[model samples]
Target: MANAKLNVLVAEVPEVIPLVQEAWRAHFALTFCTSLAEAETLLNKRFDVIVCGTHFAESKMFDLLRMAKSKPKSQAVPFLCIRVLDGELDGTAFQGISIATCALGAAGFVDLNRWRREYGFDQAREKLRQLVVSLAHQPT
Candidate 1:
């Protein structure tokens, strides 16, 4: 375990907080934020991963990624976007955003209901564990 405690900043709804926390607990030192400002504050420090939901008000996925790209500390950080809905994700949604120029590291679009049924908290934790291990081993 390179660092068992991975700093994770999540920007999602109040209801989703517990679920995300439960899901990622094994792999992350979870931090839940209802607002983008709070998320941004955490971003200013160190983070191994970021899990963002679709409903974040002030900043969306692209906005956060762009900010991450600009920051020297977070340039290689892995970003995961959690889409609650069951539709195709439009890459164009982030068009014209500065982060659009950079390839998004890794993302998993999961239907909230489906995730609960099939890949619940335990499964999510396993997935995150694998992801962290892989990222940690990658050459900079």
Candidate 2:
């Protein structure tokens, strides 16, 4: 039998779905949710990773990270939070949010603008690929 594709839970804004799907759907079995509440409902299910898009300093993405870390089934799953830049914020502000998210249990942070400009996730993609490969090789 063929191996199952890795499952990914994407909790991001609606407008960013196309970009995310183009990058992830081909490799993983993706389930998209536009809101934190919707993501919460699916927490009981299994996912290899959670990719979230941050909106502000205290965005719902952080809450999801905390909740996932607290859950037994999902606690080990990695959460990658992508910081979106609108050209209005400085690097300091973005760093602060990324730090806070990591403190709250996010596995890592990615700069969305950098990923877009690079036409891919760049370093973030490599990290995620490593994570997926590691997860796939683990015995159940």
Candidate 3:
């Protein structure tokens, strides 16, 4: 476990891919999924952690999180919700969503915009990386 590479399922929109790549790729092996169907297919495969975005067209983050947590193969995997302030949602909305996701059994939530505004880009990136890494290493 100490030397093993973390496997992350990143369910995000196309726009957020670069952000995930920048902050996550260096720390984990990531699989990107844009829709519920894509995520449904990938859920069968083993993943140490799931980092999901809130921009899917048909399904919400809660839907995706529940789907992953329901699957026998992925039920034990940690799920983290990533919220990007892309005008679709504001800061207050994101705070509510963050609390909601956590209540639904998510391992954590990352508000990229808030972190960047408060801590700056480099620090926010490291903060996210550290949170995900810590969640991935937790006991199942």
Candidate 4:
């Protein structure tokens, strides 16, 4: 399974530390694209999962999920959305994003800021690894 890494498409990658970025490359074979059009070009192939950023706007999350799930090759791929936190954050936006992504059939959502704040870097990395481990084995 280590050698047979999962293929993943990451749309609109966020700014993170090198370790977090490296962890993703180490754990999965990632294809990154900045726009939906670019992502669409890459979607001709199957991916085990699609990780997307909301681009600091809630609607972009919906757009990302919609595009990925609409494609024939990527229709069933497990889709995960990464959330961006604001400086003066409350729990309101957090809950809203979760419910929305859930309603739209996202496999999961990762709040890296929350994970790092609550669980530390080591634990956050492990959790991401565990998540990819589960999705990698999912029936395509």
Candidate 5:
């Protein structure tokens, strides 16, 4: 299905729905789930990429990440974890979370506060585009 758009599942809070839709709808088929449980259920289906909010970190997000890594259909899929900060994102906090998720095998991360404040979501959009292209190029 080379002509079909990639599928991306975003497990994030309601506040960020519009932003995510704006950034990824044009390039991929977007599915939005507001909670970790919902995301876990959706995982039974196929998605080329999974984007999770920091709020999910305390929930089942990590379990889902592990599932993706182990499942044959999603073993090579990439996951991006985005964090929404209370105020300006502290460098240390950002690093800590990034390191944690990466250690758990996330493919990448995006700081929502940074994306909105500094880049108007351009960086986030680019990161997603990169994932889409990279996945497309991989041998099935």
Candidate 6:
């Protein structure tokens, strides 16, 4: 059989969908959702990565991170948070989740202008590609 594509669920504001989709296209089967419940449903369907926007309204980003981390099936899956500020990434976000990468932005938005102008999408795609490759080769 052919190799399976890595599954990724992106939980972010609707405005960031284009940028997130562009950045993740080549590496994984990316799906975007605007709500935590929707994201959870996607997870139930199976995903290797979960990328969340730090600006989610109902819960702090860390809370969603924790939810993903607590699931045994998703514990080894990577969880990434896109943020608008710089600070220490809380270890709690990775309490059970495997890898977490925080991509910085200027304000609350994803900064798509910089993404296009600076090849930020390319950079994200490369990083996500590496992560998927590593996961694929990991011992089961």
Q: How many clashing residue pairs, candidate 6? A: 0
TM-scores of the models, in the given order? 0.65, 0.76, 0.88, 0.83, 0.75, 0.60
Q: Say which candidate scores most in TM-score.
A: 3
For candidate 1, the C-alpha RMSD (Å) to the true structure equals: 4.8
Q: Which candidate do you rate higher for TM-score, 3 or 4?
A: 3
Residue-level lDDT tens digits of model 6 in 31-101: 78877777666666677666676665443566666666667777666665554333423446433222333
Cα displacement (Å) at residue 76, model 1: 1.6
Model 4: lDDT equals 0.73
Cα lDDT of model 5 by residue, 1-140, tens digit: 77898888887778778977876788889999876567667877888778777766355566767766776776666787777546656899778877877888887666767766776667756855676568546665
What C-alpha lDDT, on a 0 to 100 scale, does residue 54 get in candidate 1?
65
Model 3 clash tally?
0
lDDT of each: 0.61, 0.73, 0.83, 0.73, 0.73, 0.57
71 Cα displacement, candidate 2 (Å): 1.7
Model 3: lDDT of residue 28: 89
* Model 5 alpha-carbon drift over 4 Å, by segment: 57-60, 116-140
Indicate the TM-score of model 1. Answer: 0.65
Misplaced by over 4 Å in model 2 are: 1-3, 56-58, 116-140
Report the lDDT tens digits of candidate 2 across residue range 1-140.
36778888888777778866776677788898887778888888998887777852236877888888898888878777776646434578768877887898877777766654565546656655566556545554
lDDT for model 3 = 0.83
Candidate 4 weakest ten by summed lDDT: 12-21
Displacement of residue 18 (Cα, Å) in model 6 is 1.2
lDDT of 4 by residue, 27-95 (tens): 777777766667778888778888777772333667868777787888888888775444423478778
List per-candidate RMSD values in Å.
Answer: 4.8, 3.8, 2.1, 2.8, 2.9, 7.5
